[model samples]
Target: MIDPAYVSAMARYNAWQNENLYGAAASLSDEARRQDRGAFFGSIHGTFCHLLWADRMWLSRFTGTPKPSVPGSESSRMIEAWEELAAERQVTDVLIGDWAAGLSPEWLAEDLTWVSGISRRELTKPKAQLVMHFFNHQTHHRGQAHAMLTAAGVKPGDTDLMLVDLRG
Candidate 1:
């Protein structure tokens, strides 16, 4: 059985991280959010949007939902309007935590396959690894987003997991 507490903790972590990210993003001028920062996505807003795209893509494969048509590259992601994408990303992260809580060992053990959005060919992998990838991928891209936000002159509050106030 998937422990509900682990899921709840992850959910809170995801929320806390994004709250800091967006809070920092908000301090920047639109021009700053859009500035090139040498990240894979090259800007705070672009990295944020790409993280959302990756989360949705992995969730689709995990839950059999339809994968979105958004291209997961840095350029296509930056073309989106920032505020709307940030809000949508929040919703998707909550859904992922909920899905993770209900997952069974069997579900995680099963292999998932989907046509690669990049290559248009079938790819399959164990679901446990993919689910882990989903969360890890979020952290990876969010770190890039965080760094870019700093370059844009916005301070994202503490990212330390130990600092999360679980009782709050």
Candidate 2:
């Protein structure tokens, strides 16, 4: 249902959006970044942390990497320090890109099974579908974060995937 090219494009888009969001977030005071903004994840910092945590969790499933230590309920606070979070985000972005670059059609075509941490039940699905959800989840939460940043008077630029020049 998906191809490596599509995944690669998404990985690049994810990194680009993250760079813009994190750059805008860096301008805010720590208090402002962490303040509860009534968002689903609480605030910009909280939302970003959750995104990172979720990405790591999904990556762990896709790869053989260790899953994130924190649970979904605590994901919002997964990385408390701003600088550390930013550095980790950069590293995770690269990891996702590299992983996507190496995906094979045979691998993506196979079914994947894993226990659901949230539901506490065994779940199975096509790898392609799960891969699509992985990127989709990032975009979903990033939208929430973009709104929060805008509310804080911080401007994260050009969220449109089409506008991202991935040619390089």
Candidate 3:
């Protein structure tokens, strides 16, 4: 069984990391942020957009929130405007935190069945595993975005989870 505390902590960490990354990314010009740097998502901006789209997609499944209209193949350009993207990111992070705060063992222990947008197939899995995937997906893409930020000459500060100060 997945611990609610761990999910909550991860939600906080996800927000913390996004804030740091977005802050650093703010220093770069729009062209620099969007320039293709050979990352899987092509650029820092593209990767960030993909991350936001994926979050929204998963959150929709998890919370019955509206699923993002963009298809998986087009996630890289879901939000082309930097300002809008950043604002949505903040809102989504808050939503994730709030959702995590309400998580319980009962909810986590159940199974979740949903249609896969990418594969176009029905799938069922433990809700706990799906919750784990939610956070894992964020971390996986953020790492790529972090590298792209570094390549663009932006330092995203420390990324160690243990060092994330959650006391505030």
| Ten contiguous residues minimizing lDDT sum, candidate 2 | 159-168
Ranking by lDDT: 2, 3, 1
Superposed model 2: Cα runs more than 4 Å off: none
User: Which has the higher TM-score value, candidate number 1 or candidate number 2?
Assistant: 2
lDDT of 3: 0.92
lDDT of each: 0.74, 0.94, 0.92
The segments of candidate 1 whose C-alpha lies over 4 angstroms from its true place after superposition are 1-8, 74-79, 165-168
TM-scores, one per candidate: 0.85, 0.97, 0.97
The reply for model 3, stretches above 4 Å from the true place, is: none
Model 2, range 65-98, lDDT digits (tens) per residue? 8888889899999998999999999999999999
Model 2 collision count: 0
Report how far residue 50 has shifted in candidate 3, in Å: 0.6
Q: How accurate is candidate 1 locally (lDDT)?
A: 0.74
Per-residue CA lDDT of candidate 1, range 5-41, in tens? 5545666787889988888888777888878888877
Deviation (Å) of 166 in candidate 2: 2.8
Q: RMSD for all candidates, in order, please.
A: 2.7, 0.9, 1.1
RMSD score of candidate 1 (Å): 2.7
